[model samples]
Target: MPDPILPLQADQIGKTYRQGATTIHALRHVSLTVEQGEFVAVMGASGSGKSTLLHAIAGLIDVDAGRVVIAGQDLSLLTDRALTKFRRSRLGIVFQSHNLLPSLSAEDNIRLPAESTENLDQEIDDLLDRLRLSARRNHKPAALSGGEQQRVAIARALICNPAILLADEPTGSLDSVTGAEVCRHLRELVDDQQRSIVMVTHEPHVAMWADRVVVLKDGNNLAEFVTDGRRDPQSLAKEYHQTLEGEVVR
Candidate 1:
């Protein structure tokens, strides 16, 4: 049998920006692949290109070089309109801020991506139940807790049934306890639902929940390691620090 196609494959992705006289290389030949049902965390310090890589893979911004293939479709080849449609159907994104509309209820928020609400009612209902937001489905963003809001955001992202979920600082806004709750939800999405996730996070505790951690430094791939949920957050943090220190020494 042929090798299975990955849910996400970013190859030699490079992006640069010019600010006055200086050139900022936000990403440099950064390549990553995420398998189906796998949770991969991209961990980096500020300006380490972690978010840039996520944007590149999601086609939120154009990369100066390299290509991002999602489910065998090359993102760079699509027209802007086509890309937007493709993204709506194929990609799910969650951000640090819950990004929920205050005016809409949680169920309405999750139904935003569907073209027709009539057809998606059952799907949305099932998704809300799965996300454990059934009771809070009618609540507005202001009425929900931080964790609930984020869970609603996740439900919204998943309502489309996208091939992979791209999360940027997904647990950044929550307290430690709430953040852990959100992380466990994401892990369940991978292990139970066979969903793939590529999350960009600076928190070691959050990254520890992933199947593997990919570290970025100075706009390049620094190192990667499998976590297997065996190691503690402190050990992961120490390893991440050592990886950066080693890169600096070299």
Candidate 2:
């Protein structure tokens, strides 16, 4: 069952960038709520305000109006320093790039963030084992395969034990096979651990792993997939394509 209270909630959020006389409205009254333990995918074409929305939710950029709440705190109310600390403590983010340090070994990369803390050594080790990186522990990023590198990235994200996981185009840089594998791993995390995940992507297969899928355009959420949580991810992809075509013809 979906959670009653939202782990992530955005209420009429808005963002505007000023380029001289022109004001770029990246997000227009965007509002969304991701329940605790729910897996949700945000899907949209390029320039559809997908990245901007993630940034706003992550507190990378302050919203011009409205409010964003994560783990029960209103982000707009926090000071810059407090917000930074809050993000580091409670938020988990994964980008398309593996972003592993060139000199760091796979194990080190996964357990890397633990270096900042005195306690978390055991937690880091457990995550390394969970991601199946114990075998390639000493291998550097350059020596690891694409899938391995992404797994290391996932380990890094989980090492923090964040309240909510946010991924932006996580599989965009991988091949079809590797992307599917990444999705498989994510599904396991959501199901086995009951982790809350909100991924931003244009791929339907990626969205299928999610319990619910949200479609966005021009910073506004369009329609949503609210059923068939048991359906295959590939079928969800096909339906998303059909929805796109139907919108185009209208």
Candidate 3:
């Protein structure tokens, strides 16, 4: 059989910005691939280009060089209109803020991504149950806890049944206990539903939840380590620091 196609492939991506005569390199030859059912975390310090890499893969911004392929479709080749449709149907994104409308109920929030509600009742219902928000389906954002609201956001992202889930600081706003709960749900989505996730998080604890962590430094792919069932956040942090230290000495 042929090798399976990757859920996401980013090759030699580079992006830069200019302010007058100053050139700011946000990313430098960064490449990453996420496999099916795998959870990969991108970790970096501030200004390390982690978020830039995520935005590049999601096609939120254009990369000056390289290409991004999602589920076999090359993002750079698509026209503006086609890219919009492709992104909507192929990628699921969760951000730091729940971004839920205060006026809409949990179910309504999840249904927002649907092109039409007429035929999506069952799909929305199923996603609500899967995300464990069935009971809170009628509640508005203000009526739900932080974790619940985030779960609703996840459900909204999944409603389209996208091939890959891209999250940026997904648990940044939640308490430790609630954040852990949300992480568990993300893990289950990979293990049970065969979903692929690429998350950008600065928190070691959050990165530990992933199967592998990819570290970025100074706009480069610095290192990566497999978690291998190690749940201790400190171990990951130590490894991250050591990787940076090694680079410094080189």
Instruction: Give the C-alpha miss distance for residue 116 in model 2, angstroms.
Output: 7.5
* Model 1, span 67-160: residue lDDT tens: 9999999999999999999999999999999899999999999988876566598998888888899999999999999999999999988887
Q: What C-alpha lDDT values do all the predictions have?
A: 0.92, 0.83, 0.92
lDDT of 2 at 118: 60
Candidate 2: tens digits of C-alpha lDDT, residues 89-155: 7888889998999898987777766536665777777776777777888899999888888988888
Worst 10 residues of 1 by lDDT: 241-250
TM-score, per-candidate, Cα-based: 0.96, 0.90, 0.95
Count of clashing residue pairs in every prediction: 0, 0, 0
